[model samples]
Target: MTFSHDGLRDSLTMLAAPPYFYENLRRELATAERNRSRFTLIRFQLFPRDEQASLASEESQYELAILSFAEVLKTSVRAEDLCARLGRFEFTVILKAPSAVAESLTSRVVTSWSSHQEWSKTALCKSAIVTAKIGESSLEILNRLDNQELIGITQS
Candidate 1:
């Protein structure tokens, strides 16, 4: 019944960092390959659009927004969904759903942030939702999402 420190750490939460995200993503892709099911990859970028706030304050504000947003995401999605903090201003969610469902979820998230007072201060939030393609590598999907060239729901 004993567990190592790493085991305890691994058991903590579904949310993951870049390294773990990449590893888990690889496994998830493999599972999708075997099951012949698709998953949606959604990326969220939260930032403050106000120029009045100093860079330091803006960063701190964004940090708070990120935390709040992460909580919302964790609560909103199903337990099987994977969430990750990809960077300081970026987050990725892996959902076992179609792109339409992912789009609906993305829209809901953006709308929820608008009404949430804490997220109001961090005005600019954007989300891109795309379905995982068959025979596509995890890196390719992540790289595509990272491009930010894809149009997504954005609220100021």
Candidate 2:
């Protein structure tokens, strides 16, 4: 699919933008349906622990924390996996793997992000994982994942 430069990727994180992400998600869903294969979708969100104090005064730092967390995500997944930025503080990863493997990868990502000195202090990370089901559309899968209560990860 054709997309403007900005439409294809998020400027700050250099990850796929929503249009590109959804297009790929649709393609993946179709493939999974046809082949009876499974793939995992993980949604991640970052929120300031103390919004007023952290975001109001440390806007730049908050942005830097997002950038760092994005890097953590990028490095944690396989090269073939699709990583995308869904919103200012939201991201998603599409892994062509079974649910168990996806959960392991999710733990790695969470641990790496939480261990980061700056990122952990600046933002709280949360994630939800879902596996594509037979006959489900991309929107349906995404809606289910989004509706699920996110699992939060914080620094110890």
Candidate 3:
């Protein structure tokens, strides 16, 4: 991927925010150089089912659910990966591995979630993976098994 002088200049001249953004970007670029073939976007979700009204009354259940999800994330990926907290009920993970890696991560995530749910006396978790774009970056071949709502984890 050859970058013409002008294109390279434009990318490098990002107005200016702070040195931190550039430093962080440089670090990410260095890491990308080491493993460039794969990138994944994992949407970790924790949707409380409306049907599970029993869980509604149990604040501790929600706490357990959050803790369980934290366990899954902590156990699921490498130390260098990025995990974004998108919402109270969701997370987005970015990994250095390829698309197949993402698909496998999804499976591991769901499997681990299922095991945790079983321990918590709840139903299995639902999950999905999808392709995301970051301009010239490459993409991976992944099977996105999201929820009925396409947020991962199906519910009635």
Top-scoring candidate (lDDT): 2
The CA lDDT at 6 in model 3 is 31
* C-alpha TM-score for every candidate: 0.80, 0.91, 0.58
The per-model lDDT (C-alpha) reads 0.71, 0.85, 0.51
Candidate 3: tens digits of C-alpha lDDT, residues 1-156:
111223212121211122332343345545555655445556666654556464446666665575577667768888877654434445556666667888788777777776664433443355556544343222122223233234344322
The sequence of per-residue lDDT tens digits that candidate 1 reaches over residues 1-156 is 111123212222335667777877888889888889999999987655677864246455655666677777787788888787766656788899999998888888777777687675555667877788778899888887877554445455
- How high is the lDDT of residue 65 in model 3? 72
Candidate 1: lDDT of 101? 93
Per-residue lDDT tens digits of candidate 2, residues 1-156? Answer: 112238788878888899899999999999999999999999888877775764536667877877898899889888889999887778899999998988898889889987886678778888999999999988799999989889996547
By TM-score, the candidates rank as 2, 1, 3
**Per-residue error at 142 for model 3, in Å?**
16
How many clashing pairs in candidate 1? 0
The lDDT, on a scale of 0 to 1, for candidate 3 is 0.51
